[model samples]
Target: MLIIFSIPWLVWRLLKTDYFAPLVVVQIVMGIVLGPGVLGHWFPAYYEFVFTPTVVHSLNGIAWWSVMLFVMIAGVELDLGKAWQHRRESGITAGLALGAPLLLGCGAAAVLLGFDGWMGPKAQTWQFVVGIGMACAVTALPILILLMEKLDILRQPLGQRILRYASLDDIAIWGVLALILMDWSRIGKQLAFLIAFVVLGLAFRRLMAWLDEADRWYVAPIWLALCGLGADWAGLHFMVGAFLAGAIMDGHWFNQEKLDLLRHHVLLVMMPVFFLSTGLRTNWAVGGTEVFAAAALLLVASVAGKLIGVRIAARVLHWAPGEASIIGWLLQTKALIMIIFANILLDKQVITSEAFTALLLMAVASTMLTVPMVEPQMRRSRALAGSAGQST
Candidate 1:
């Protein structure tokens, strides 16, 4: 844990490229470096000493709860009201943004099926394909917010529009994840759980409303844990339950500033452990060349499909020049959400370690590309608008 916190700061201080590679990105990279594949190879004894079975298990527990809290916060923060107000535009853009990359990624997944190490033992061909496709389509809303804040555009119209589009896609991403994780043998229990959840959700909301603000905060984690247990009992993952816990509750119930601070603190205190654990899952048993090659293929599909889809939406909506390009690049930034999505897929045995590694690399590369690509386009657009204003 000490290593996890310190490495990112060292990288941030030394690298000095926070715009392109922020502390979160550095943490992720450090995770890979500290993982079994790299560090274990270099110093097997030291690696074993540091990450003994007990230590790894403890880390996994931390990672699980950390991600659950993070995802719950994400669900709570979703501005569904805003998206509904601009339903027409948001739907069109979100649909195309999700669909195009999904199709492209499906193609890539189809090709990967010809290989030996990409598919998990328990996954059906269709499940694996759709899982990969959805991973490609996801936009890391939390990371996007962080980046937009850094860029000083978190309150801007463009940022808000992007958030709307990402929010809609976030809903679709999790819904598809639930589908992929459905266990037919447990269908009855799953159905029962859903029914019970809705009934209980209403009761929970009323209880929360009746509670004082101080008490509500104290009770939130208990609710979070119960929801997680119920969902896992029904064969859906706990993360799904965590999301539902937050989604069913009203964001306005809590103070917005407090909620934001909780998210920031979680990222600060817990998320690095999750990143390191995710990195430890990376395996190169299929060979580094093969992994890198697959990563490249997925990266191309993710980037090209996103841009093409956004361009189509821009044409349809008659957005001004350069809007689509910037939106596309921002939308393609996939780090936290994609990693979490991929982690779930791996947990459910939908994708192999090799495939997970490839997806991880693609996410890191795509996220790193976002700020550098968007900044120049943003500058050009602002300059053009300024010139037009002066001429007028």
Candidate 2:
């Protein structure tokens, strides 16, 4: 552990677009060895610490914490009151984000082919395809934060506007997922579950408001943790409940900044554990040609669909050409939700191991690609902003 940190952190200063990428890659490779793919296969007891049932539960906890922190931050960062003012453009971007990704996923599924074993068409192919497609969105929130910080556009009106609509875009994704899960067959009691969800959402908002008015940020996450258990008790996945609670608080009196501070610690501390743990589940060997070919199609379609949809939506919002373009490309950073949905589907057996492998590789590839494409725009936006400042 000490040796790993002593290995020169300064090296990552060069590739500034999400420094976590390379580190995550290294961890993932190590995980492949220590996980079921290698050590779990050959020396089960040697790698046993990594995936004991207890460790599995810990990993699950980390993932839920990572995402719940994300949602809490979403609630904190978005100026929900201001966002409602632009209901028109926000509506369109939300609509497009949901519609475009689903379409792209479906397209990817159509040309989809798979394999044998506990891997491929041994299960539900079409359902897998539809699930994958529906789950392929690259959310704009985190990517925008990173992009704006890099470009010095964090405080600009364009940035604020981007935040405005993109915040709603964040909310819309969850709402849509909740809607989809509401009807999902395995979920079984979808209607009763959904009704309970809405009720919980209302209660969550009130919970946030009370905490905020009382000036107690510490209590917020406790409330969230409780909500997780409550959701479980109500026969819905706790993560889904946590997400809805965040979405429900969008325009409420919650101190977004306060929650942000609280979640920062957890997000940094627990998230890597979650990622490595999740990465351990992936058996990269089983995902061969059929999966690769499908991933190829999915990647091309996702890039095109999101870039085109966002660009057009940006124009409708009256964004400058360059802002529109950068926003469009950067929004294709689709790592978090993509991985979550994939895990859910894979666990459900809707998608085979082959498709999961394909999706993981391609989604990571697209996310990595989005950063490079965004760097140029970051430079251009900064130079343009600087020149304008000097002229003024």
Candidate 3:
């Protein structure tokens, strides 16, 4: 863990390129380098000693809980009511942002199906296509928040608008994931679980309303565990349940400062283990060229599709000229959520390790590109807006 955390910090400090590649992205890259693909290959005995089966198992447990907490926080943080208040703009932007990349990514997935190492054994053609498509469309809401905070825009009107689009897309991304993961054989249980969850969700909300803030925090984890277990038992996976667990709860129940601190601490302390575990899963058995080629394809599809979609929305909505580019690049940021999405796909045997590696690379590259691409455009826009206001 020390090695995992230290390497990324050292790189970030030495390079001093936090604007281009934040510590999180560096950590992700370090995970890949430290995985069997690099470190394990160069120093087999050290890699084996450090990441023995027992140690890997421990890391997996930490990764699981860490991601669960993170996902739940994402769910709770969603400002659905605000999105609904601006329904038309939010709906149009969110739909275009999500749909365009999804279609392009599906096309890419179809192309990949011609190859040997991309599809999992259990995945149907549609599942693979849709899963990959959703991956391309995903915006890592948590990471988006972190980046916006770093860019000093988290409280700005523009930032809030972007958050609305991302929040809606976040909901759709998980819904699509649930659809992809639907077990036909377990349909009965799944339906029952949904029904029970709705009823229990109402009860849970009431319970939360009745509880004091301190008590609510205390009961939150128990609620998370129960929901997660129930969802997994119904074949939907615990992560889905974790998301649902928080999505139903009102963020207003908790102090905003406290929630933010919890999120920061989770990322600080626990998410590195998750990143390392993610790296450990990376495999290059399908050949590095093929993996990288696939990554490039997906990255292009993700970036281009996002830009095109947002441009279309801007045109229709009559947004100012440079706004689409800024929004598109920002929305294209995907790291933690997309990785988690791909991890679930790999776990369910819907995508091969090769596909997972490609997705991982795509996510890292996409995230790294965001701040650099958006900063200048955002500054220009702000300058233009300021001049217009002064002239007025």
Candidate 4:
């Protein structure tokens, strides 16, 4: 753990990687570098010595709970009521933003289908395609929030608009994941879980309403654990349940400052283990060149698809010049959530480790590009707006 945390921290600070990648991005890169494909391949003895089966198992437990907490926080932070208030705008932008990448990514997945070592053994044609497609469409809302805060626009009108679009798409991403994970054999259990979720959700909400704000924090984790166990028992996966556990609750029940702090601390303390664990899962048995090629293809599909979608939204909304570029780049932030999505797919044997590795690379690259690309576009937009104000 110390080695995992210290290396990234030292590199991030010494090299000042945050101007482009941020500490989280650096940590992710460090994880990949430290994983089996890179470090383990180069130093099998050392890798085996450090990441022994027992140690890896312990790390996996920590990673699992960490990610569960993170995902729940993401669910709790969603402001769907605000999205509904501006339904037409939000719906159009969110739909386009999600749809375009999904289609392009499906096409990319189809291309990958022709290749060996990409599709998982259990995945159907449609499942692989749709799963990969949704992976492209996901926006890491937590990471997005972090980037926007760094860009000093978290509270701005423009930032809020972007959040609205992202929040809606976040819901779609999870819904699509659930669909992909649906096991017909366990359909009855899945249905039962849903019904129980709804019934119990009402009770949960009422209880939250009745509880003191300070007390709600303690109860929330109990809810998260129960939902996680129930969802896993039903074959939908525990992460899905963690998200649902959060989504059913109202954000207003907690103090915003404390919630934000919780999120920050989670990212700071726990998520590094998740990153490293995710990295440990990467496999290059398919060949490094092939993995890189697949990653490049997905990167183009993800980046181009997001820009095209947002540009279309800009045209329909008659947005100001350069606005689409800003929103598109910002929406393309894919670090955490996409990794989590791909992790789940890999967990379910819906995609191969090679595919997971490619997705991981694409996510890191996409996120790294976000701040560099959007910061300039935002500056240009501000200048244009200022010039127009002067003219008026």
RMSD of 3: 0.9
* Model 4 error, position 380 (Å): 1.5
Ranking by TM-score: 4, 3, 1, 2
**lDDT values, one for every candidate:** 0.93, 0.61, 0.94, 0.95
lDDT, candidate 1, 1-392, per-residue tens: 88999988898988796989989998998898899889988999999999999989999999999999999899888989999999999999999999999999999999999999999999999999999998988899999999888777889999999999999999999899989999999999999989999999999999999999889898888889999999999989999899888878788889989999999999999999999999999999999999999999999889999999999999999999999999999999999999999999999889999999999999999999999999888889989999999999
For model 1, the superposed segments whose C-alpha errors exceed 4 Å read none
Clash list (residue pairs), candidate 4: none
- Each prediction's Cα RMSD? 1.0, 4.2, 0.9, 0.8
| Better lDDT candidate (2, 3) | 3
RMSD from true fold, candidate 2: 4.2
In candidate 2, what residue range of length 10 has the lowest lDDT sum?
1-10
Q: Given candidate 1, what's the lDDT at residue 233? A: 98
User: How good is model 4 by TM-score?
Assistant: 0.99
**TM-score winner among the candidates?**
4
Q: Top lDDT: which candidate number? A: 4
- The residue ranges of model 3 lying beyond 4 angstroms of the native Cα positions read none
- Candidates' TM-scores? 0.98, 0.79, 0.98, 0.99
Superposition error at 190 for model 1 (Å): 0.6
- Give the distance in Å from residue 381's predicted Cα in candidate 3 to where it truly belongs: 1.4
